[model samples]
Target: AGEAIITPADKKHPPTIPVTGAAVTIGVELGCAATPQSLQINGNLSNAVEGSVTPSIQGTGTVSGNGSGGSTGGQGGGSGSLSITPGLSATAADTVTTGGSLTGDIGPGTTRDFPIATKPLSGRDGYVVARETRVSVDGCLGGAQIRSYATAVISTPLGENSITTYGRTLFIDRDHPGAPPKLKPAK
Candidate 1:
């Protein structure tokens, strides 16, 4: 909210001053983006079980994204924060502004929504699983000219035990390309 004024004021005769000053609002645009991700398997099983499994896992390849952008603006001398200095004779703009959002369903990673692979095991037989994920956000800091708010919710519990007991992995090498052929049995 701003102020209004008049001059030569008496009980019955008051001067009429027109309203004035800069507009009270602004707007901006926003967007989202993503990148490529992949996985490779290596390593051999030691003391192999007397059973076998055939697996067929399909993956979604690399990805990218874009988003819309807008700005919060006012009718002023410059693009700095919006403020006013009250005095006898104040000057400003009467520009009215609206707001907009720059949003995209984008990130550094993508969901492999489709099931990758399945395996059937006999008694005392087990399998392995590996997961790698990265997340980030940009250009959303709160400032005098721009304010930002973000909320993140994770349904997955936090801990090693959050994973299914038997479907978990015993070892893996995310950076390494190949696994050695010989592995001593898991005592």
Candidate 2:
């Protein structure tokens, strides 16, 4: 997992104005038997100014998972990554970028979520708006399913800004028998 920042328009500003960094933390809990877990996180921030416009881009990614198994128990693992980019086209405006990701696996099932935010960082400043999220899942008893949600708002100092939000959910279950053991299928 890692993060990065790109500056394509800020050659006039000092290099110190643009910086990037990332960090990650992981935790795991097991009831019994052997369990393995791992995690990674990363991100970046950058900005550039050219003429009367400033452009900035930032991104982040994370991956984590756990697995456990006994004589009959099954093992599971999961991971995911996300990123965002924001830019200001004119000198009289600001831009923001944000994103998140998650993934997990349990037994014969898997789940994932991805969220993104794009808007002005400040509300009292100028017109700002944008939001988005998505989710997906798969199960041994079900096949595969996906859902999406989004929101956006535009505001100005003179009046109030418009607001919009939406959400969705999905589910699936299917039976899938993996390859038999090296010997033969369990009776």
Candidate 3:
């Protein structure tokens, strides 16, 4: 991550205040020791930000979900685009169920969008976007990591601006001692 300042090259530069802008660049490398054939990702959306995870598989696989669509509320609204890939299968739904296994098929090399918004009924503290996602990639021997991008818009009296952030999450099967107890341990 890094940042730089840009100064105007106009005559007013003598007394001009340099505008300072920041840029953040993030990168990650996930090492999977074994070959994976299938992949699954259970995701969540919270408080004014939207994101998605894409799993690329070399062979056939199934994904379960409510499909894709858009919704609007008194506060805000969001929409999703459909995946257009040959041999791809999917289910359609107006609302995406939380904490449930999604049922659908995302074509290889394509991605899906999961829109998120803070519920209107949320009380003060606004909303803490804390949720656990379980990811399963068949044939993975070591571990798996997923990365995605999230963006939010900040509105103020001055103006409104959008900012983007990178997110990374790791997946460990219950077979490993580090896995949460709720997850079924390997037999």
Candidate 4:
């Protein structure tokens, strides 16, 4: 929500406030359990101003499924966790956290939903806005060769429409049982 007020209630002339378009930043990180249990990471965005920004995910490891985004009003806070349905024989340990709702369907080597806002932000000047992206090991299971990570895109019609980021890498060796799974950040 955005509200405006006269700064200096008693002042004769109110100074003109400088409004800057919001700047969007995307970040990716890996989250791992103690053992070779699961792989996960956090994806976050910092908006320099106030507005509605759409976030989407695309990856090689996961197949794209159909899903709708959440409601479109007010400010959505915090990065929530999403459990992806496994497409392969592997157990369901994979998950992804995108500030926006998951769009694509959930399955091994398949990324989640893509959110496109019908309404653009008002392009008002405000405080710094923070959003999160989380990627878990559950997404890297199943299939002949599991894709390690996915690519993230944050877009806003206000200024820069699209900014791209990537996920970390997971090393899974079926032959070497003793060699536990390893998680590495995107290079």
Candidate 5:
């Protein structure tokens, strides 16, 4: 992990800030089904700012949660998008017997918007994946649910100038690829 010396939006009175909000993910249940189902969602959110790093780092972040059309089964399918206001919060949630559930948050951090590092801040793209299962009363229904978020930032080392930059997230997956997980750990 790399340490990010965040330049405050205000240059006159700079404050100590770090690059937070790496991403948060939660596994969801897709419910039980007579047949297995595969789904995928894709989206991109980006924002760039240009200003002095004195009183405040001048810039705004604009992200649109518009995912690619989702796949559907013979019975049903799903689709959605998010238009978030700058410095505002947005949320959505729901539940069904067959499809699992998901609750997620994608926006700027409490202290600041994701640092728009001038260069690829080690694009290590650090991320965390979580999984969970919730069974129905009959024990024959319920599926694993998962939700993940990734965050990154970059900037010049202290005693230097800054530049303009931006970033976004890419959600991807292979439907039923059929690649089994390795049972044994690498020696």
Candidate 6:
């Protein structure tokens, strides 16, 4: 969603030093319910980072309804976090970057963790600490199309002279006639 960097005041040069770190924790969860013709699902994912850099990520999603024939509805949401250490490999071109990816269902009472590959850089070597969270929900009412929503956030540290950027994606699906396609037309 959003991120901020804290710089050490003692550093002589700007806060633009390379660093290394690792994710020390990961967690995930899932929930589901079904009737004769209807069904409901929810899940979530969370992660923590330590070592050279520290960051965290979390998300939630759900899917439910009578796919065969009936009424139903669903909804979902999620977010992410990250942290970075400075001066591990101080260099003129030192820099730090972080990012992650998420898929599947995420919702309440659900969480999971994923391992990210560490990259080695010349001149300034730094670690990438990152995590991601996702959530979703879906359902249908009679012949009407059901609805679902999902959200995610990611954060990372940057060199004093560097900048960080973030983005997200959303998908939906329905089986009713006149139902919109899984991917909405770009605005």
lDDT of each: 0.29, 0.39, 0.40, 0.35, 0.33, 0.33
Instruction: Give me the runs in candidate 3 sitting further than 4 Å from their true place.
Output: 1-108, 119-127, 133-145, 148-150, 156-159, 169-187
Report the alpha-carbon TM-score of model 2 versus the true structure: 0.19
Q: Candidate 1: global Cα-lDDT? A: 0.29
Candidates 1 and 5 compared by TM-score, better number: 5
Report clash pairs, candidate 3.
63-103, 63-104, 64-102, 64-103, 64-104, 65-102, 65-103
Ranking by TM-score: 3, 4, 2, 6, 5, 1
Where is model 4 more than 4 Å wrong at Cα?
Answer: 1-19, 27-108, 113-135, 139-159, 173-187
Off by over 4 Å in 2: 1-106, 125-141, 150-166, 171-187
Using lDDT as the measure, the top candidate is 3
Task: Name every residue pair that clashes in candidate 2.
Answer: 3-43, 10-48, 10-49, 140-174, 141-173, 141-174, 142-173, 142-174
- By lDDT, the better pick of 3 and 5 is 3
Per-prediction TM-score, please?
A: 0.14, 0.19, 0.23, 0.20, 0.16, 0.18
* Per-residue lDDT of 182 in model 1: 68
Which has the better TM-score: candidate 1, or candidate 6?
6
lDDT of 4: 0.35
- Residues 1-187 of candidate 3 have per-residue lDDT tens digits of 2122222357564523322222222233343445534556667654444445454434444554444445752344445544544443444335444553544443323122333322221221122242353333444455544454444333335554556565545555436637533644558
Best by TM-score: 3
Candidate 4, residues 12-107, lDDT tens digits: the string is 875354323333332334332223234355456544433344444543442344444566644433444455443422223334444633233333
Model 6 scores worst on lDDT over the 10 consecutive residues at: 144-153
CA deviation > 4 Å runs, candidate 5? 1-5, 16-141, 151-187
What lDDT would candidate 6 get against the real structure?
A: 0.33
Of 1 and 6, the candidate ahead on lDDT is 6
Stretch of 10 with least lDDT, candidate 4: 143-152
